[model samples]
Target: MPPASLPPLPLSTAAGYQARHLLVLPGDVLVDEVETLAVSRFAGARWDVVPAGVEPATVAPRTAAPGEPGVLRTSRHTTLTGPFAPGPGLPPGSAMVFDVVTPRERGEAAFPGSGDRDGLGRAFPAGLPEKEERRAVDWLVEAARRLGGSIAVDVPSSGAPGIVLTPDPGVAVDMTLYSDVWLEPDAAQAVLGQVDGRIRLAMDGVDWQGPPAGIADKPLYRGEQMDPAVRKQIHAAADDVDIAALTSGEPLDGYGLLLDLGVDGMIAVEIGDEPDLPFLLRGLPWAAGGAVSYRVRWEPDDLAASQDEFPPMEYTVARKRSAGIVAALAKALHGAVGGEIADEAGFLVEPDDL
Candidate 1:
């Protein structure tokens, strides 16, 4: 059992202040996977939708159902999960949430915390004692290696040790080792020459909690007004899913931060959902919902004979963009038939279009 000092949700609500660091996972993975990973080795690790009234935590291991509104009561943290839209029961505040991701979650360490300097509404919290720093990094690196997908991490301010693993395999310049700790010449070469080139060195307390950079250059515009930062983040996340679905053919995973800025209502997209990436650009009928939507459906009509090199096959394609305030302008301008042609259908919106 954790010490009595760690307050539960109800009590914390009354106090009116909640602090926590959100460890957002890769969208492709299931929430259950995150829960399972927490119990496998990192016991204090947990996820929540965050509460309102101004916000979200850990305990016995349990999982919340998709879109369910409730609290997970365990030995460690009392986590409240939900859509949190300030509905009938879900008021408007913010979820006071955190995960037991470090040694401190188990009562093993501590560190100094600080706010973001980039003018973004995020924080770079401190934790992980000297004895456990390397071990934590190693564990995180190993997890990244196993996941084999795009991932990133944030470290505390004060130049403490922290790293985020990305998929690009490019050695970024200005990588930080620790407080005033830059990679040595030999170490830098060795690091770059080594195996997977996905590791990213982070410093000054920043979280790699969004999509991989340049996942897609397309822009998505929403009519609903929101903070520019939040708008940009969600657009990037949508591009991530858009590329994944079109190329890799993966279903929409979902989008949102483990913790939100609490500055505006969330505008998110989820897999197995409507107003999704597919119907929007695929020229398929989109189910009406408050959210911007999309869909697509196609079948191989007939194979065309190619005289020279290309694949000896051809089929028709159709595409379109959403008409919402934050809709995508069909970039695949096939006669502007909503970005569709006789055999090909699609479009691309630049990042700046938003």
Candidate 2:
């Protein structure tokens, strides 16, 4: 039978819809270009680019008492995070955070009780462009609406800028910017447009590769008793192909070492209990190629034991969730960077299950 046609998920009904909108605010021109290229491949649903120092606002001191010299009074300062509370529309998750600092600010003293020790606070001499910042915010708000989501911005006391999105229940999108100066409106919009185009491509299935072919060579390996002529013939037949060689007691191991070999996919054949296949597959770089599969051989007794150890139900759910996340992230990143394929690190979590 022919393969089933993939169904389309409207932005509103997408499984991980919240993670689909990506915001990138790189302070450096070179780094921003690289990140933009990386994100474009996945086709981020909504992409925004702004100055690096922008962030979502947290609590800040409102005002000081009138006529009070050197005595500061605290008052509540209104910020966007107040209205955007964490809820079903905004799920909690962790991400690996990175920041860039200039040489002048590298040795700046931290506040007495700074919560984040790694945070540097030297005031770099760069003008902030308010108009451009507002434009970025406007782009985000419009994008969110198109995706049936909401936007949240953070402006912290440390003078950094942040952008966050609450696209749906149980998901929150956050990004920070730290650059020498604010980005111009033209440049920021150009980046956003690039991302928008890529996201469309990703949604249309531009980056997927079909399943790979099975192992191309047989006899696994020739024995010493085999004639040299026969062995040479077998090796010749296996040329430019992937073949697995195994030993009875040796831990199964083989390397694909052919020069200029173009592999469309990969499969790891193992002689072990099925339960061990998952762990073995984890060691392979599954993201590098088009497709990946696994084949395992086991003794009859081992197979029975492994059957009990493997949780087929849970595996199926996990697999589906992972696939959904991959697709969503790929589309989102492609949208953000203008249609460039993203690296493995970009898909940080399984959006559906999260």
Global lDDT for candidate 2? 0.25
Summarize candidate 1's per-residue lDDT along 207-226 as a digit string, tens digits: 44556675343345546556
Task: Give the least accurate 10-residue stretch of model 1, judged by summed lDDT.
Answer: 171-180
Candidate No. with top TM-score: 1
- Residue 5, candidate 2: Cα error in Å is 41
Question: Which residue runs of candidate 2 sit more than 4 Å off their true CA positions?
Answer: 1-34, 37-91, 97-130, 138-152, 158-164, 168-354
Error of 2 at 95 (Å): 1.0
